[model samples]
Target: MDTTLQDPLVGRLLDGRYRVDARVAVGGMATVYRAVDTRLDRVLALKVMHPDLATDAAFVERFMREAKSVARLAHPNVVGVFDQGADGAYVYLAMEYVAGCTLRDVLRERGALPPRAAFDVLEPVLAALGAAHRAGFVHRDMKPENVLIGDDGRVKVADFGLVRAVGSATDTTGAVLGTVSYLAPEQIEHGTADTRADVYACGVVLYEMLTGAKPHSGDTPAQVLYRHLNTDVPAPSAVVPGLPAELDELVACATARDPEARPYDAVALLALAREARAALSEEQLDAVPPQARAQVRSGAEDRTSVIPRVLPLPVEHTSRLPAPPDPGPAPGRGPVTVHRRTAFLVVAAVLLSLGLGTGVWYINSGQFTRVPAVLGQTEAQATQRLADAGLDVGTTERAYSDVYERGTVMAVDPAPGERIRGNGTVTLTLSRGPRIVKVPNLKGTPLEEAKKALAAEGLAPGVITYAFSRSVAQGAVIGSDPEPGTERSPDSAVALQVSRGAPIEVPDLTGESVPDATATLQEAGLKVVVAAERIHSPEDAGTVAAQSLAEGSRAAKGDTITLTVSKGPRMVAVPDVVGMKTDEARGELEAAGFRVKVEKTFPFLGDTVTGQSVEGGTNAPEGSAVTITIKGL
Candidate 1:
């Protein structure tokens, strides 16, 4: 699609005002050329849409829509669109031309960038995204190909017009747009666009910059979309060991399945990028080779050695045991003072002989084997090493940890091979890693406030569901999954339900006729169902008389309402109660599902069962209670 001309648009005027120069670059949909606005005497980049695309009415409409949308955005990092028009068969956009290679070019030349350099590249991308997001625009097609690195090392994001085309899906069936590898889960699942979607693509670009490879790639775009939907991106640390944990968290947060699960937008991402870069630099210095450290200086003022000092043990009464109680001479030895004195010497000689014999035996048999040190080693390695040292391995316990690799021993008691006797249990304290508590309930809280709460607890944001809620105002969270106050492990997902708008009320027309009622309900945006019933009044015969739930109640769309229709008036023999008091008989009749009609009691029937008509039980339409004529005799 490269257009060459000697006297070509090179100095030739366009639209009788702007003069075009040499072609700069060619792309699938447009050709960029260096041009000058003759009237303003300023340099500009002329981007002419492919003539083929211009022929498609639909593409032209979409391109114009994009142009209109991008024209509203004003951002420093975003390449601005100055003018858009059609001349004869060609459509062109005059834009600000950045005079540098693209991020793709840098990546191709450098293979994999250093951590800091990658951060440098992504920082500006995030900035541009942040600005677009703030301006109510999402850069849907964010990829390295659309990022231009200027000769001044400034990175400017191009192709802002592409967002409108991609975000607004023309096909209702949810087609994938832009580069599939960087598509967010929601974008693929619902054809929904949001700020996080761009954040996700930028994250993939950052990953590519660091690893010299895209985290998600496949043979086809569809395959890539599927992977983005189903697969979790492995942490950068996993691929390149020693990568900063902060960087990994940043990437993971951006690529989270839920849109609200990511950092608020690219604005926050840029801030996090700076912090990650600093932290990584500090870490890299500490991880330098020992030889390098030694060559530096004697007292290099080490910042990493912040661990507190501990005191050494001193030797004192090292092997002492509790003294045994001495026993006095027996009572039977007291025959007299003289007899006692003689008995004392004989007893003393016996004690002295016993003590001398015990001392010789104690020294001969009390040697103990020292416990061997086996802490901080893998289970298999530690077990084998312990066995080789004539020591029996003890039980093992596993726990999640960030410090020790999984299955490594955290510590051992009676450490290694300390010997007392034969069989002994060495209490091993395995590294379970760090403790993690789940995210707490954040519903009803502001998003920023909830995020702060989650950050304090070491948990991350998860899915954010939006729905219209009358109770909860718009933008306010209605509820959250894992519910509020539920404990979760660190990095646990925090789902939120945000309010969309006010809820709509459903009309109650349960008593209306079927045809008339259906029309009325539909007009009021309510669904209806009719059920048959038999009633006594013309108002209740073969017509909807009652509603399942009361009318004027608040309900959302698609809520079902049942209608009770009449099957004409039904009759049955009235229950007989000759003498029972009015209140007592009324309770019994009502409990039996019959409507009660009470008349003033006659003088003789204050509280007695005197007579009966229709007996105690009879078939009825379930609402007939008879009157009692008491004391007619």
Candidate 2:
């Protein structure tokens, strides 16, 4: 049965973002889990602090702050930190997920390494540490378990939990924060660590790699700590008889009991390692120690070289042989006595033939070949460069990378510095550039929902702005600046416009006098504009007749309202029509655009108009009413 099935956090979604899949490892401080970043659509290792430590607010704060600084320290060999947060009882860090085993796994599988293989692993580890040291961080916990070897053969340094700034107090609650086996003497005695402490641990690791065993053995961790504090790490040559002097000197220099005697930092040690490698010959570089274990093969070994595969020399070269017991040949053959001159000629001829053959072989296959470094180079450049070195370009693959530019080589197979056949094909993995995502249409979405939507799409919510939108509800997104469907790099900030509900309201003001309307509009925090020309209207003179903006229109504060003044009424000469019939008068009056009314003088009989209030044919205001009397008695 899988033990992870019983782990409480195995199936939990942490911080509403990381979906934990399975527990990867459990340490004293935290439990690491293989998880998916649901928001970013990527896989990441989620290291959740143990519940006991999560309760410490100061520790949690320091952990997150350190994580933020580590996130900014971006190097190819350092595992990347993408995010950090807390949820309920879980405080976690989301890191780049490396798909391979740790150096501890490698050491357990392949006992001791030949010099070439040991150097191959050591160089990258030192490079990573050198970078961290220069950047003012000391990885106090340097152990095989913290060195990650990816399936692609890349070496990455991980778990910066115990890492701290150069001069900070190097202990928590007065307890050392490192594995007992790899802690330096200073770390054990004085509770302080610096770049030199990392160097000492690395020296111990180097000794283990070259000798297949630690210098000191103990029944318990207490014994191990006692040994680290009391004794010095032994030279590899002491354990492995044929190990080279150069490596022994390196281990001795790095593991000096006094911090002042060790290399100042990993950078200085890396320089020394390179110099030591340069001084050794090919035979010494590949010398296999007697204690090095032959890995039992169930199947073909993994070819990628984070921890390299060391090939051993022939048995005759590695093992000692004894002289024959019976020195004399058959008695008859000895008495025969072969000619010395002929034997000499034959030996000389054979030597000459061997020399010529070696020359021919050297010409045919020039020399040793290694995969050339083509990282961050364009495909064309990498191909041409590989061709120049007599190596062929193999299959090319593409992967997204934030560190390398698009179309540039991101990784190589038979990776950089690994030996290869003269004509071996080097596989290239190119960068496809940072992942691009389309901004989602967030119009009409609630502010919180829109932010969540952006995060889900691998984008960050940028500055927020509030605007009045008649069509969009309050607290809902009015629109985005990039609009919608624009392509953007992941984590790009997107600005949002949220609705502040409908704008200011404007009331009707058409029939009010100019001064009165101006005051009304001003009281409403609106500006007023009066028309230059007055127009004849039903409203009295100097009163507002029309407004520029229509009634019920939406406007904001400080908006302008235009008013047109009325010119009272217009008049013209009246024409006599006293004798005209009431129907005729009515027809004429109606035709003239005047409303007409009739009044009967007596008992209502005649249709004739005997009198008119405004004499017939008079021009009144265009839409005014006129009255007429009928003679009837």
User: Who wins the lDDT comparison?
Assistant: 2
* Worst 10-residue lDDT window, candidate 1: 304-313
The residue-by-residue lDDT of candidate 2 on 1-633, one tens digit each, is 245767998756678667676688977678898776655645679988889888888888888899998898888889999989989998989999886678777678777877877787789989989998999988898888888887566888997644442222233321232357788889879888899999999998888878777776666666777888888888889888977788989999999989999999999999999999999877787777777666543222233232332223212334333323544556666623444544665687678768975764443223436566666679999899889888999899998766567998767776554456788899999989989999999999999999999999999999999888889988899999787999998999999999877776777876787888888788877798888999877667778878888878876666788889988755644545578887787887777666788999677988888887886555667657778889886
Q: How close is candidate 1 to the true structure, as a TM-score?
A: 0.41
Candidate 2 versus the native: TM-score?
0.48
Q: Write the per-residue lDDT of candidate 1 for residues 1-633, one digit (tens) a residue.
A: 335555344544567655565577766677788766645645678888778778988888888778777878877778889888887666888888675567765556445555665666788788888888887878777877788876445678998855454333222222333367677888878887788888888888877766667787666566777788888887876766676788788888778876777888899888878877777644342332111111111131211111001000111223333333434555775437556665776687668768964653333212233345454467777777666655566777666654445567655555332233334455555767666686576667777787788889888778877788777666767887787667766887788887765755656664467678777766655687766454453245667666666776665555567777766446554455555766777676677666665443445434544554346656565555555434432
Candidate 2 lDDT for residue 261 = 100
Query: Against the hidden reference, what TM-scores do the models get?
Result: 0.41, 0.48
Best by TM-score: 2
Off by over 4 Å in 2: 1-3, 161-178, 297-633
